[model samples]
Target: MAQSEHLTIPVGTVGSVDSVGAVDSVAARMRALDAALPARDGVAVFNRVYLAVTEEVGRRLDAGGFADPCAAAALDVRFAERYLAAVAAAAGEGRPPACWRPLFQLRRHPGIRPLQFALAGINAHIGHDLALAVVDTCRTLGCPPAELEDEFDRVGDLLVSLEERIREELMPGPDVLQIADPLTHLLGSWSLERARDATWTAARALWALRSCDDVAEEFTDRLDAAVGFAGRMLLIPLPD
Candidate 1:
């Protein structure tokens, strides 16, 4: 049960209040993820890498003492949006949008880079607000997912930076010309491939967890191997 003191809802805001029911849903979702993911038993670690990291983003939004996930998530979104706008304005050719785009082609990846820096601030706030159980579970990470609420905000920031860089430098973003071999990217000047790999591995694990139905010994064995690799991915510094 959540502590009553922690349940205090501040007044005067549009979405200040929270209910016990909403909180239960978040906990249930996490349990479902924990059970579903461990089922693969680890053999197919990389199989789900592409999809998992993006979804696991939630673990950061509802960190400590959040009785209402909606409230927690809403707060996170607002902070991220505001943070992105401010930084993008400073970085962009002085233009900041209500929402900044992330991917060069897709919808989620950030187009700008500096926005990522401001986002780090917002992430800390979310981490501080997480529930006790959630905090304990992810305690191993010096700065866990719960601390990264500004992730989306950073994405927006990057978009603005990209735009500004294009206008000012008349240059292409990040690595303008594509390399013949991706391995070159992984091992190139300050290769960010390592971070990309980590995100991919973690995302894969999440995808596998989200998809499983069978709960057997073989499944458990595979899940173990998958997590072992995923854990190692997290340890490597982002290759920038």
Candidate 2:
């Protein structure tokens, strides 16, 4: 595990008017994280992928691509904080969420491919963090999940596109990949589209269960474990 490195930006409420600054602050922190880690570190690999996505999202926000800039910024920042918090926790004595533990634990292993690290991080973030981020955004914006649907869908679209690009850029080319390769099968098994769909459902369910604290907590814990299990599968070491 890496030593604790404090992230300077404080996570706080972002009102509608401060959306741009909030997004910029989040992007800045991710840039700092990217600079701090060794390039081959699994966490660093994932961070680079995420940093690209964050930069693109920031560009979209500046270009007015989202219908609700305030809602989009809130969702984007809250979504990012979950991943950052996990990194921070793992850096210190505290443990990250179950969903994120596998990647952090195996980040430096020789056998795991960069693509595996990238997807595993995506699995942890999308499968687990996204739902909670939705709830967090709702609480901050004082609106129901339904109201945030457009922003959610838009952000998800960006991730789905990025997933495709990640596979292309990191995975062995089609000419090089063999049918018997475990990486091929593993890649075939998980789909970001499926994960995003499931996340939306989970977010809605969580919102519905918000009034029931114990039940919601149990649901979240179960979700965390399930996603972590999937992440572990995604990070399975493959032969060179």
Candidate 3:
């Protein structure tokens, strides 16, 4: 594994606004991360992938792809804020969510390929953060998860589409994906579809438990740990 290091901006260095209704803020954060990280670093690879997805979401929103653009913007911003907060927290010597810890911790291992880093980050963010983001959006909009389902689906679709391209762009080769390869098996074991299904379920469960703070806390903690475990597995160093 790579030496442990933090890649997030320092707390208070950037504005702590909860969400970004405008694309400028999210774009700025992406640029900051891009500038701060080396291209070969695992976190940088994942950040590039995620930045593209976010930019596409912004373009679609501007083109009126969403029925409720406001809700979509809120959900998008809230979802991204969770990630940015985790990075900032890590940078400030504070604990980040378990799901994010592995990416930061294993960022520079030579044996771990870029695709692994990107997919592992996606696993953690979508599995844990996206569910919580849904809840956060509902709270911000004074509505329930049902009200934001459309936006959630739309965003989820974008992520799914990106996953396909990520695989295509980063996969070693068609022959390399054969079952004999460890990377192939590792990549095959995880599916974005399954993760998205589980995220939606978790979001609904969180919404149901919003009234019971204690239960919700326990549930969220478990989700974080579970997603983190998956991320750790995905980051296993592979032979060159």
lDDT of each: 0.30, 0.89, 0.84
> Between 1 and 2, whose TM-score is larger?
2
Write out the backbone clash pairs for model 2: none
Count the clashes in each prediction: 35, 0, 0
Ranked by TM-score from best down, the candidates are 2, 3, 1
Candidate 3 to native Cα RMSD, angstroms: 3.0
Which stretch of 10 consecutive residues in model 3 shows the poorest summed lDDT? 10-19
Instruction: Assess candidate 1 and give its TM-score to the true structure.
Output: 0.19
- The sequence of per-residue lDDT tens digits that candidate 1 reaches over residues 46-91 is 1122113213334433353344344344433333333223333423
Better of 1 and 3 by lDDT: 3
Q: Estimate each model's TM-score.
A: 0.19, 0.94, 0.91
Residue 124's lDDT within candidate 1 is 21
Q: How well is each residue in 1-240 modelled by candidate 3, as lDDT tens digits?
A: 122245555322222334334554676787788887789888789889888988988888778898988888777777777777887776666888999999988888989999999998899889999999899878877899999989899998999999999999999987666668899889989999999999999999999999999999999999999999999999999987
TM accuracy, model 3 = 0.91
